[model samples]
Target: MPKPSGRGAADSSYAAGTGIAGRGVLLDVGRYKGSDGPDDSWLPLDANPLEEAEPDAAITLDDLKATADAQGVRLREHDILLIRTGAIERTQDPNAEWDPFGEPGLTYSDDLIEWVHEMDIPYIGADNLAVEQIFQTVTEDDLGEGRKSLHGNYALPLHGAFLRDLGVSLNEVLDLSELAAQCAEDGIYEFLFTAAPLNFEMGTGGPVNPVVLKATDGAGEEGGSEGRRGRGR
Candidate 1:
């Protein structure tokens, strides 16, 4: 790793001119690619069964490109990307046995990093924490506790690529179900987005509740949960 750089949550801390702000693009991958096509239009019925592998699946660059084409949404530079995988949704059922060690999400890829860098995407987030999948596949290999994220371990390479190398910020664990519903109904995937952490100097990370203000025929809507997900420095 690159030495012990003290770039904690304080770096991108919600300061006056700093925090994250820009067009937010929602790529509901869980719907279009992560699951069995859209159920009646972009989301499976709440009462219906959730998509399997919400536990272990990779949202690859190919899936990303296909989602954009399916939504008819154009990718914009400097855009804040929020990918909804519905992985979290699967675990919502209290009766289901769930393990947090590994779950489905975006995995690392050289091409993806290149695309993010080239597009200058300032931030990327998802419904799952760790944004990048810790377990690369369906069968989670127990890499001994805490050893999975050890320095030099390729488990969470994107964490290093985007945050460490390209200086792109990352945030996660957002409740994007409501947001997904809104987008599918309106067919508008772009909106004004902003988020920031409570500035606690030198803190590793802090909680953030992203705000979304949408413009739809002069009407507006806001959807998000007050959740705790640390933001990268």
Candidate 2:
């Protein structure tokens, strides 16, 4: 190997920890509330499915709850929450024009941030560019008395809420199509999720390969853990 460089060598870092393994809970918001079918009763009754009117939507905490309820999943503390908004899938299509701005996914809210903290969720992942909306929405509280501004104060609030303040790690741009389809097919949303990030202790962020181990019946229809690739920019 060449001489060691910079501050450190043979070392790297990720938020909270270097690697993560946990009881992964997937809330497939795309399949549950996308521009598809409610084909069965499991679909949330009040799901504002992806459509023309709200192409640039932001999934609220209620949306997450409704999705979880529809999928029969009870959110637990320390559970790895992986949400699929289908944003990654759109990027794969040749004709589709994927716009990162105002993309539909989790956005910052008082209740949403509070719930994440109160639940003690250590990590969160999503199939979007940012786990939260890339273009954040501002409110009156952020505006204050004068036109003081929202550019900095309200831009991607979740970044500060989760990463800065809560110390929660966020994995974004995940290719969740395969996992979502598989989970929807078998009706099993919980799995053993494990990931080992490239060791870069000095760096605040690094890439990881997330693998999902799903339990199948003795019939052996499904085999073992499926390594889902992380979608790159």
Best by TM-score: 2
RMSD, one per candidate, in order: 7.9, 5.9
Give every collision pair in model 1.
none
- How does candidate 1 score on lDDT? 0.65
Worst window of 10 by summed lDDT in candidate 1: 40-49
Candidate 2 per-residue lDDT, tens place, 1-233, comes to 88645324222254325467899988887776676223321211112322222532567788888888998988888898998877766677565445666467776666677788888987788987778766554555434356445434244678777876787777888888777777777777889988776665455556777888888553646745565666211
- Which tens-of-lDDT digit does each residue in 1-233 have in candidate 1? 66555555535544323676789898988778554233522222122112233432667777788888899999978988888877566557565434554456776556687889999988887877677776443122323345455323246777777876887767777777777777877788888887776665545456776778775542554443223343444
Q: Residue 20 deviation, candidate 2, in Å?
A: 0.9
TM-score of each: 0.74, 0.78
lDDT of 1 at 22: 89
Instruction: Give the clash count for each candidate.
Output: 0, 5
